[model samples]
Target: MSGAQRETTEYAVPAGVLGLKGPVEKPAPGTLPLRGDLAHIALAGSHLAAHYVIPHVRTVGTEGAGLRLAPRADGEIFATLPAGSRFELLDVAGEWVWGCPGPQGPTGWCRASDLASAES
Candidate 1:
C-alpha cells in the first residue's frame, strides 16, 4: 500500500457513530444476516437523524430531560437519547414511562419529561 493519508470531508454527524453494536433486532427463520453498520444518520451531504420511530410515541422531549434506566431523576443513565430520539412505549405509571430504543430493544424507564409521551 502506498503511504497516503487524506482526511475525509466532515459532515454534520460523523459516520463512525452511525454503526450499531449488533443487529437492530433478530432475524426470522431463513432471514439473511444484517451488517453491523446498518443504522445511518443523515449529514449535510445527507441529513441528520430525523426520527427514531418507536411503537407508540406520545411526546418527544430534549436532553435537558435526560434518559435513565428508571423513571426517577437519580436513576442510572442508560443512553442519551438526544432531542427527537424515537422510543417505543412500554409501560406508563403516573409521571414515568418505560421505553426502549425499538421493539426488541433493552427495556428501561425514562422520566416522563424525557419522553415524547408519558401516556399509554
Candidate 2:
C-alpha cells in the first residue's frame, strides 16, 4: 500500500442477478461461484467502434460484422454479425465461448471460459 491509487468497477444486478438471458460475468477472474446456463460471449476488451469480422467465420448468414451502431435494448439486437465472418475475442471474462452456430457458422462471439471445463 504505497499510496498507489486503485479504481474499481461494480457489476449491477443485471450482471449478478440470476435468470438473466445475457451472459453472466464473474466478479473476479478465475472465479465461478455464481452462474447458470447462460451463453458466454467474447468482447474486444474495450468497446470498439468498428470491429471488423474475420473472413470464413460464421454468423447470421449476412456478411460483415461491424461496430455497435446504435443503442440496444436489454434483449434486443446488440450487433450485426455477418455470415462467414469471424471476429477475434479480446479480453474475455471467461475461458470457453458457447452458443449455437448461425446459418453461416457461429452465432456470435461468446466466452469459452466455463465451456473449457465441461466434459464432452
**Residues 7-115, candidate 2, lDDT per residue (tens digit)?**
4322112332334354434433212111233212322231122332222222333334332212122223334444454443322334323233322223333433212
What is the clash count for each candidate, in the order shown?
A: 5, 17
Q: Summing lDDT over every window of 10 consecutive residues in candidate 2, give the lowest-scoring window.
A: 30-39
Residue-level error in angstroms, candidate 2, position 19: 46
lDDT of 2: 0.30
Over 4 Å off in model 1, which ranges?
Answer: 1-54, 117-120
Compute each candidate's TM-score over C-alphas: 0.43, 0.20
lDDT of 1 by residue, 1-120 (tens): 466653443123443465444434444311221112221222122222334221454445755234555467787765565677666554567888665555444456666767654544
Locate the minimum summed-lDDT window of 10 residues in model 1.
Answer: 30-39
Against the reference, the lDDT scores of all candidates come to: 0.47, 0.30
